[model samples]
Target: MSKEKALAIFTAVPRTHNCAQAVAAGFAREALVDTLHDCGGGRAPEGLCGALHAALLMAPEDRREELRKRFAAGAGSVYCRTLKQELKFPCAECVRLGAALAEEFADKPEIR
Candidate 1:
């Protein structure tokens, strides 16, 4: 995942992509994006987080949990609304974190 690209997508005007969509799309492109949207529900509350989880569903349980923990540690919450309202976490930062984490785990043998 390209952090720059994910950030761009998350911060884009009109904001078509959410944090999950940006990160998933950055790493796996259309396939992941489509899977996320289909599985996670497009633009629903916490949809991005759901998409992230869905994207990594096939990975080992520990790896999936680690990714979730990483996201929570960085964004304060995986949910967009909570991150924004309670933690004041910026969408751009979430996108960056998501992208960076995805990149870190993308090549892992157990991530598929």
Candidate 2:
């Protein structure tokens, strides 16, 4: 998807440099779309935002449960921990950062 279109998905998310970079990188377009759909469909799992980000990173399924545990307290801040440590954006910026990265990654042509 185009970076603009990808960015549109994250319009509601707080914009940040990480998010902008993600959009520029095009890394997790489908995952972000799925996350929005799930969230909109009212079936988003607990700590959905963080889970979505982790999934997009291709985190192992076994790790997902553990990862989810980290943010199970309904604390958005906990969710941000991974993004902050991994991408240098605090929890406040995960949504935007994830979107940006997805867009950025998508815009890149396949290497192989």
Best by TM-score: 1
Q: Please, what are the lDDT tens digits per residue for candidate 1 over residues 1-112? A: 2767777776789977656677666665776676555333225444445434533553456687788887788777777557667778666676677677766666675534
In terms of lDDT, the poorest run of 10 residues in model 2 is: 35-44
Q: What ranges in model 2 sit over 4 Å off?
A: 1-9, 12-26, 31-36, 45-57, 73-112
Residue 63 of model 2 has an lDDT of 49
Cα lDDT for residue 10, candidate 1: 65
Residue 50 of model 2, lDDT score: 42
Q: What are the lDDT figures for the candidates, one per model?
A: 0.63, 0.39
RMSD of each: 4.1, 9.4
TM-score of candidate 2 on Cα atoms, chains taken together: 0.32
Instruction: Give the TM-score of each candidate.
Output: 0.69, 0.32
lDDT per residue, candidate 2, 31-96, as tens digits?
A: 444434433211234433542453344434434444434433333333343434444544334444
